[model samples]
Target: MIIPKNIEELASYAEKGKNVFFFTADWCGDCSFIKPQMPEIEADFPQFNFIQVDRDQYIDVAAEWSIFGIPSFVVTNDGEELGRLVNKNRKTKEEISGFLKMVEG
Candidate 1:
């Protein structure tokens, strides 16, 4: 997953191609639970670029996106939002894959 250096870089990613902004924090247990499965998820969906955004580090960015929860996903394609899985809950690989598939179509 690509980690944006700044909000501007993140914006550029959103404008370019299919991108999944994964909002997470180091201290978030839910985030940790899904961290191990991310590699496989990326492999399964090669078309989308996964960008890891630390919620704490990018509080302003998260706020801009209205992401109040950790371990959330915001999908974008060519600068347009496709879908989102925003909530304060634990996510499974299947759930994440389902979200990706839904947005892909």
Candidate 2:
């Protein structure tokens, strides 16, 4: 997974191919809890490129995307939003997988 340094890199990722933007924050408990399980999710879904974006670092971007929750996952391709799994609560691996399935469908 690529950790985008700036908005330009983030845009480039979405503009090129299927990408999943993971919105998180360093202090978010839910984000930290799911961090360990991301590897398995990434391995299970190889078709989409996953990128982590720190909400604190990219406040403007997060705001523009209307991401008010930590550990939000937004799927996009060619700059168009395909689907999203966003909430203020903690997410399980199954829930994440289900969201991907919905997006893929």
Candidate 3:
């Protein structure tokens, strides 16, 4: 599993290809819960890119992207957002897999 260090890395990923993103903060309980399980997700989708953005550090980026909740995900292709799973306890590997299937399709 890949957890990006900062927004620059996240954008660098976007420049390459379609990607899967996770917007999370180190202090988030839900993010902590899902961290270990991310390998399972990575094993399933080797082509997708997973990124992490610190909510506390990148509040403006989060707000600009309209991410009002923690543990949010955005899947995009060619700079267009195909789908997003925002909060709602959708922080599990299963949920992430499901979102990927829907958006990457």
Ranking 2 against 3 by TM-score, winner: 2
Q: Highest lDDT: give the candidate number.
A: 1
lDDT (C-alpha) at residue 46 in model 3: 79
Residue 55 of model 1 has an lDDT of 95
Residue 4 of model 1: what lDDT? 93
lDDT of 1 by residue, 1-105 (tens): 999998889779979899999999999999999999999999999999999999999898899999998899999989899999999999999999999998899
RMSD values for the candidates in order, in angstroms, are 0.8, 0.8, 1.9
Model 2 lowest lDDT segment of ten: 5-14
Off by over 4 Å in 2: none
**Candidate order by lDDT, highest to lowest?**
1, 2, 3
Taking all chains together, each candidate's TM-score versus the true structure is 0.96, 0.96, 0.84
Q: Report model 1's TM-score to 2 decimal places.
A: 0.96
Which stretches of model 1 miss by more than 4 angstroms? none
Q: Model 3: runs farther than 4 Å from truth?
A: 1-7, 88-90
User: For residues 1-105, what per-residue lDDT tens digits would candidate 2 score against the true structure?
Assistant: 789887888779878798889999899999999999999999999999999999999999889999999899999988889998878989999999999989988
